[model samples]
Target: MPANTAPIKWAQRSDSLYVTISLPDVKSESITLTDDKLVFTGTSGANEYACDFEFFKGCDAEKSTYKVLPRSVQMFIVKAEEEEEEFWPRLLKDKAKEKNQVKIDWDKYVDEDEEEEAGGFDTSGLEGGQGMGGMPGMGGMGGPGGPGGGMGGMPPGMDMEALMAQMGGMGGMPGMGGEGGMGGMEEMMAKMKGDLENKGGDEGEDSDDDDLPDLEES
Candidate 1:
């Protein structure tokens, strides 16, 4: 009698999908998923193997629903090809050699000295009386609080006017007395306090002013 071939068996569960193919020998090679298909490569000893047919194409569809198992099926056997050696390793070696042949430009790297030369910085003006503060808190000369008073004990080399000007111009801060200036906060607080005091003093001031008549000849 001819050797009976069994069909491959497959099963699907909530967490996983499985497929089994049988070879003639009990010790076949491992199976793998390649290009979304299951590939069974037999190892050195296997000539043929057999697995259940229900896993292959055209099994009972109604029996294999989401919750249930399909009808029982017989096994099928497939002949295994002899394993081919040395093919994969040589292919990888050639690919690596091809990749290493690619050239990269070393000239693209920038030198540190060249980068510094390209950056513009001048130190000529940073000399002599050029040092900050001819006096305390008064940079250069003729700073605030008049000559020699030196900004009333403020730090040396500190110039309030230049600092304010630089802050206003470069940092987009408001001018000294503008609406958004620091002066606005002080002026607002002073006005609030004056208004509150005037409310209490209003009646007394009115009475005193009324009691005093305009100057007339007696």
Candidate 2:
């Protein structure tokens, strides 16, 4: 008897496709890839499953990769031609083949413009080895391979734009005048000194007034 066709989910970016096979604890598995096709077979317990996908266009099989997770097999497929990257309207070359076995992976999906905006931000300049002079660990908190690394030390699912805006606001604080760093301390100290001098002058004026003889029935 022929093996059953395994169910699959998929999402895509401009240059890559993310595919997930919903077969768990596979005892054996086989995967084959070419410029325009993918073939998969696996066994779990007594059940055998298989699937074949004819891609909408050429793919770079050499650069693609896959991983076997506890509950799924995840695959990342790259487009053959990076210079002409674009999202395929559908995953399969034959539209009719996109039937019950395949579905959209909405959880991993991002539209073209959204992906562009997220990827366009250049973060190289933000990697200051010493974050906020007095704050240790802050520099390495969100660094690559560090804690909360992928999200830039931010809580998971936090909006990047919102975080950046918050940081910008911090730069305006009394002791955070320059790029929200330690330089603000100097500005705050100077302002405090001027305030103290003004208060001293006022006190001196009051003292002189007190020294004047009281007006006698003027």
| Top candidate by lDDT | 2
TM-score of each: 0.17, 0.53
Candidate 1 segments exceeding 4 Å error: 1-6, 23-25, 28-30, 43-46, 49-218
* Residue-level lDDT tens digits of model 2 in 40-78: 899876999999979988887665656566688777666
Error of 1 at 44 (Å): 9.9
Q: How many residue pairs clash in each candidate?
A: 16, 1
Tell me the lDDT of model 1 at 207. Answer: 68
Model 2 misplacement above 4 A:
118-218
Residue-by-residue lDDT tens digits, candidate 1, 128-216: 11111122211233334433445444545669876656555554346644665755644667889999899979865676667787999
